[model samples]
Target chain A: MKHKPRLPQGLLTTGSITLTVLVLFATLPGYASIYTVILLAAIFMYIVLTLSWSIFSGPTGYISLASAAFLGTGIYTSAIFGKMLPLPVVVGIGGLASFCLALLAGALTLRLKGIYFSMFTFGLVELIKHLMLWFEINLTGTRGRFVIVVDHITVYYVMLVLLALTILTAYAIRRSKFGLALQSIGEQEEAAAHTGVNVTLVKVSAFAISAFFVGATGAIMATRWTYIDPYIAFNYLFSFMPVLMAIFGGMGQLYGPIMGATVFAYLEEILITRFPYFYMLFFGIILIVSVLYLPNGLAGLIQGWQKRVWGARYVHP
Target chain B: MSILEAEGITKHFGGLTALSGIGFHVDQGEILGLIGPNGAGKTTLFGLISAALPPDRGVIRFKGEVITGLKPHQVCRRGVARTFQSVKVFPNMSVLANVMVGSFFGRPNTVSAAAAEGESVELLEFVGLSAFAAIPARDLTLANQKMLEVARALATAPELLLLDELMAGLNPTEIGLAMDLVTRIRDRGITVFMIEHVMKAIMCVCERIMVLHHGEKIAEGTPKEIAASKTVVEVYLGESAYA
Candidate 1:
């Protein structure tokens, strides 16, 4: 019988820590205040976005700013179908819609590399937002739509499921042959192609897969809003926040984005509640400091210290 | 018998004709060297055969099948693989992972992870990079990086390999090892089409040599005949000799 490959020690430690935290959070609603439950739900949403964004952009260095486009598509799907279908089916359709949109967008613009790719992806958000706006103004005869509301507990549970799925998918892809192709493409696309990677197909498929998570999260979160307009659904902050969180946490390990999104979301919550007027100013300062000093992100900073303290013998390098 | 053949290969980058009417064939299990002065379109010809760039006019046949207009990855899957003029190893990946990428995706059939890893390890040993398999590719010396690229290309299990300027930046010792590696590769039944600027390495290792000048083929013969050709000496060797 073939032996199963042993998991790396680092991965095992990380996996256990993740499971512990997940179990704690899974039971939090029973004992904690509703405020804590809601806040955790919001944190889960950010984690899903940041983790999914890193799934594609982290390894490929594509720097996509198109999360809002997919998220908004999911929001709209939920708005249109919330009353007709059940929650799970609606979320599935939302994810599928975003996947299709991403496939078309990726195939068209992935040929453009570096900053050009970023610009095109950012432009995709604005294009979709305006297109939805025009459709609402001209054809729908309505500007905003109401969504069917789910209980806060149900919303929290769904968000938890999504967070789990995103983590699992991201982890699985990162350890697979497909993930190696993505990294190779990022390092040297021409060489990767000559080495037998179908660069276009890999790029497009990853783009769509990442979008699936963002879309599903958006679908679940839409129920909490109860009503969403194009502006609310397609906010550009959704596009930028995930990128920042991933960078702040670290892009090196799977937990890097998870750590980043958790800290960033918590900070945002605290700032908005206590220092509403100056929250963004403080948030901006923290982001700048992290970018300037923690070049490798939080995980990298920790890894660096581990190497120094242990004299390189303790580290894998 | 020829394993790879190209005819009437022409490419134009705007107004500059990079390659024009270039015809060549790589005999099975032979090392065919291509040499020329700067801007002779040597790399461009490799690009056309490997499908990195399209030929405005040409038909390329591999194993008696037309492969003209196929994508680079498609060409690779058909058993043709290439290394870039400049080393293009995936810098952030481990040396073994770099080769694994090739073994996993280079073939028509899918490769299991364990099988890919085993093949990658063997290729790394073949290229004398077995000791450095776990280190990131960017940490390797330039010569070692070139060897890593060779290992990666070989992991694709190619029947025909195209190497562009494999010894351009290497020292004399490194060049000797690279030449030895090429011969070893040929002995293993892989046809090698190489572009080289090192006259000694090319003359000693290759059975036949082709010369290009101003995007056109100038001479085609055995290494001895090419060395004795007045036209080649006048245009290429003479310039190098003066320098």
Candidate 2:
């Protein structure tokens, strides 16, 4: 069979423009109220986290559960530096630290395949969290550190810019040689390797890229919250949430994570407001149903539906 | 000097010696045919040379470099590319996308999108798959899938191409087309080494033939020489079948 170019036009133009406008409006000074600003911040953070996770886990199927560990590393590294250094420097340090940590993780775990890799990553997160607790004296002075707040709007804008950058980077990687290599590995590792794709290097590169964004987002997140602790930084729920969002959005597609984050955030808000005790249960059910019926997630389901409709029309005409 | 050489290759699976002390060489741009019975270890030999399996003892030299235990990707980057006996194209991706994968990542450095696309299209055209470029690989027929596999390997721009039973499930017409394609590949200055069970295709296309029995090389020579070998006949027929 021959290759076909099937880029969606709507996604390239109208969808991107609308998203940019919406993000800009949300972060604009004196535009959204303080409460709305907080909500927007939460949504953006989730989107960034989900997109970062999708980079490695979605296309390559590595399924690293160590995202929160790297995120925490970034959060704490930036939080420590932010106390002493400038904000931009702190964010840079966070990205560097997270990237280093990802490299370490990749080196140790790249040899493992499938579920074993996932389990090892999950363990790494737990190990990092405990190590953070053990080294409390040096890291937190026996207590959690806090960054004094001076500019909420500045932080909001920083996040918006970072989110845009993450999306752009993801899009670039998707179309680049590295992206194709990673996708081939995800589809069939042995076959990809036989065809000359350096599987280990590709996986490691992906993990590092994922770490850079997750870490930057973590640094921003710590500043937005004005507090940092290993408990919240290495939260298992945070790691799992991004995976769910990626799966919900459409695994390897560019906008899947964003769509997933938007839906997930809204769902959490609605369910928590109406039935706080049962919200978790409701969320689980929704995820199960989405996976069962739309195994490719929302983006795939929608694409499949569109193809069917169009195919029927062509046949009938 | 031979373009590709294997020296003292051996592999063991627990107590089973899949291959023991096997060695051979292929001249540049030559179509070297390999034939063996089910347990003769032809696939294992391909795996060892291609770096899919590490040999217990052996040295593989491609273009005169010792590539004993390089990883599969490393071997490919060193100008050796291969296709699996079983069809292994990326099923979910479009046929064009599958070939583009080779052009994009087959070499170490990145190729431009236009260049990659052009190369991929040329490969598809060479393999007679230009018409199905936009279709998903899963939608292709068995024969076309095998052709696509060959196209993908070619996109890697390897100096030597290894094909594994590409004609196993192909019809006679498809087999003829594949043989023609193999000849064209050789005409383009890429050496070809293939494993095959179809005697007719091998005899028609191969410059020389290597025969294996019970993981050992029983004979190696031209089609006329290999056909008349006593050991080759013994391996093909059990003692009773030959009698």
Candidate 3:
């Protein structure tokens, strides 16, 4: 017997609300303050990074700390080729460069499990950063390069499109058979392999796909910073922030990381402006408290509240 | 004709030999019981056949084609599937989804999602887990989890199914049910090779039994012949007792 795919309740309302928000975002440059547009663009970047990170790490349980490597690849691509190529072409090439790097790196190191895999990826950022620094010092005789600056409005629009694409990709993957295979791999890798899932291929491909978005985001965001060196481009914060945001948001559902990044980024902005010295202190405290109390993150907390409020009426399928 | 043949199968872990020059052949459409004491390399042999682990020195053939060096997934697609000795269900996935993984990727050809889902449900029903289809697999009892593993293996549509200690943790009633399930599975025309410690269930269900002692095949024959075999009896109930 044939069965229709089941969607969760209130998806229609959520879709409409998202569409309305997108419309507002699309038209924001006309009325909103320049600062607000720039701030929102930063928020969008965080969302893309977190969502992309989750697309691979969330389902497959492969925690990679190589976001900076991919992002740096994009930033460097833009720094080197920004003047030579059109903006779209530069961004595409940046993404493709990271994709290839991830493909190579994934094939080599994806065999390592748990903390070993994570450590290898973490070391990858340092490796790339140092290698780039050495290349600049020896071959190019340059420490850093100035990226061609695009207007704030253009940067905002590009980020928004990338955000939309990342979301769509994440959502599509979460619902597809491929997503099921990823989840199974996370649950039991050996069993998944024995059950006919090509564990290595699925893992390496997912890792590479995730890097593409981070690279693309870095390509666009590079314009915001006119001058960048290896250290600036490959800062480890870009790697850890996505993981933190995803944990805070929850990885169980598609909206979790998005909500986490948006709220977290907005909070960071407000705290930095209000109390620059104490902002990081407060942030650390809040993260610790959330980690301790909210084991499943915001999504799980929301799910619990919904179950209590709606009783048996709410089915979370 | 034998559906699976392993010749000169030897495996070593550093200094310890898991299996030494082991050889066996399982006939097509027969339920063959592999019984041995703890660490006789019964599961190791299964791992070798299913390509979970490679043998250091051996040739394994399925349908007369060497399958020794293939990946686990490749072996599975070539119609050999296995259940783990310790149940390995996808804990967070629903019971039906656990089975659906097999249906979706087990065979050589791609299966439509709807068809896979339907087949999964039917397999779940076959294993009496239809009632728990929506529940996460981890929430099921150990016996039920093993049943889910069986259902999942069956979803792969394997011609040769390797069941490793399927009845180990089962109670007497569950053991009876499991024995019946094995017979039913054999009747479906799939070759069954099982590693089992539960003598009653294994003896009643398997058409032929192979005895292993310290990684060597001590005896191989029908259940009655095995029961009367001197070496097989001595290996299980120490030689001093018969002496």
Candidate 4:
């Protein structure tokens, strides 16, 4: 009999920690006050967005500003289908719609590398957002929809499930051969191609998979507002926040963005409450400092320290 | 018999001619050396053969099958593999994981995780990188990094291998070892088509050598014949010899 490959201690430790956190959050709704619950729900939405963005942008080294486009797709998909089908089915359709957009966008934009891809994606979102508005305006002479109200607890639970799914997908992809291919693409696209990675296919599929998570999350979270327009649905804030958080956490590791999201989320909460006028300035400063001094972000430091302790070098040149 | 054949292969980057009607073949299990001056299109030829870039003219046949326009990954799956002129190891991955990426190429029959590990370990050991397998690739010395590249290319289980500048920046000791590795690779039934600036490696290792000048083949012969050629001496050697 062949010996089973031993699981890395790091993976196991991280896995347990994640499970513990998920369980803790699952139970928090019961004991936490309504304000805390609402904040937690928002935080969890950020987590899903961060995870989803990281799924494509992290492993592939593609800076995507199109998360909002997928989010908008989900919002519209949910708005149209929420009353006709069950919540889960509506969310599923929203995810599929986002996947299609991702697939199309990936095919068109992934050929451009580095900043070109970033610019094209940013442009794509703007184009999509405007197209969505133009279509909405032409069809209804107005550009918003009334959504079916879901129970707050149910919405919270659904968001939890989405966060869990995003986490699972990220973990799975990071450890799989597919993730290897994507990582290779990120490191060196031409070399990766020569090394037998299907650069185009991997890039496109990663885009679709990343979009699937954000799409679902957006759809499920839509009921909280009960009315969403292209403005709110395709909010550029959703597009920028995750990219910054992923960068701030670290792009190389799966947990970097999560750490980034948590820290930034809490930091934002404090800053906005205490110094509302200067909060944006502080946020911009943090981003700039992290980009300049800590290019690998917080997780990079933690990973380096861990590696040094274990006698392995940090995984960057 | 020829394992790889390129005929009338031409490439141009805009108006600049990189390779013009370049044609050559690598025999089965032979260490064929390609020597050229800087910008002589030796690396470009490797790129064309490895399918990293498409030829603007002519066809390439690998294992007697037309593979002119195949993408690098597709060509790789068809039993052609290569190393880069500049080391392109996945710096963020573990040393073994870098090799594992190669092992996973071409529909590796490693159905189980253990089997995959075993295969990667074997390739790592072959390239003499087994001891540092747990370390990330970025930490390795320059020599070890080159060896890691060789191991990764070998992991593809290629029938034909294109090694670009494998001996570019190495000491005599490392060059000797690298030459031995190339010989061992050929002995194990892999055809090695290599580009080398090191005359010592070309003279000692290659069974046949082809010289390129300005993207065109200027000479092809045994090492002695190449060494004796008036054109080779004037164009490539130009009064330099290493003991």
Restricted to chain B, the TM-score per model reads: 0.97, 0.96, 0.97, 0.96
What does each candidate score in C-alpha RMSD?
2.3, 3.2, 2.0, 3.3
TM-score of chain A of 2: 0.89
- Docking quality level of the chain pair in candidate 3: medium
Highest DockQ among the candidates is held by which one? 3
Model 1: per-residue Cα lDDT over A1-317, one tens digit each: 00135458866998799899889988989999999999999999999999999999998999999999999999999999999999999999999999999999999999999999999999999999999999998999999999999999988999999999999999888878889889899999999999999999999999999999999988989998988999999999999999999999999888899999999999999999999999999999999999999998998988899988887766544
Candidate 4: chain B TM-score against the reference chain B: 0.96
The lDDT per prediction is 0.92, 0.84, 0.92, 0.86
- Candidate 2 ranges beyond 4 A from true positions: A1-23, A137-143, A224-227, A304-317, B108-110, B237-243
Native contacts matched by each model = 0.90, 0.76, 0.90, 0.70
Worst 10 residues of 4 chain B by lDDT: B105-114
Tens-place lDDT digits, model 1, residues B74-108: 99999999998888999988889999999999999
Candidate 3: which pairs clash? none
lDDT of 2 by residue, B1-243 (tens): 599998888899999999888999999989999998997999999998889999999888988899976888888877888999999998877888888888877777768888989999999999999999988898999999999989989888899999999999999999999999999999999999999988889989999999988778889999888877778877773454233
The candidate maximizing TM-score is 3
The DockQ-derived docking category for candidate 4 is medium
Write the number of the candidate with greater lDDT, choosing between 2 and 3: 3
In candidate 3, position A6 carries an lDDT of: 53
Model 3: share of real contacts kept = 0.90
lDDT of 3 by residue, A1-317 (tens): 01236555566877898899899999999999999999999999999999999999999888999999999999999999999999999989889999999999999999999999999999999999999999999999999999999999999999999999999999888888788889999999999999999999999999999999999999999999999999999999999999999999998888899989998999999999999999999999989998999888899888889888898556364
Clashes of each: 0, 6, 0, 0
TM-score of each: 0.97, 0.92, 0.97, 0.92
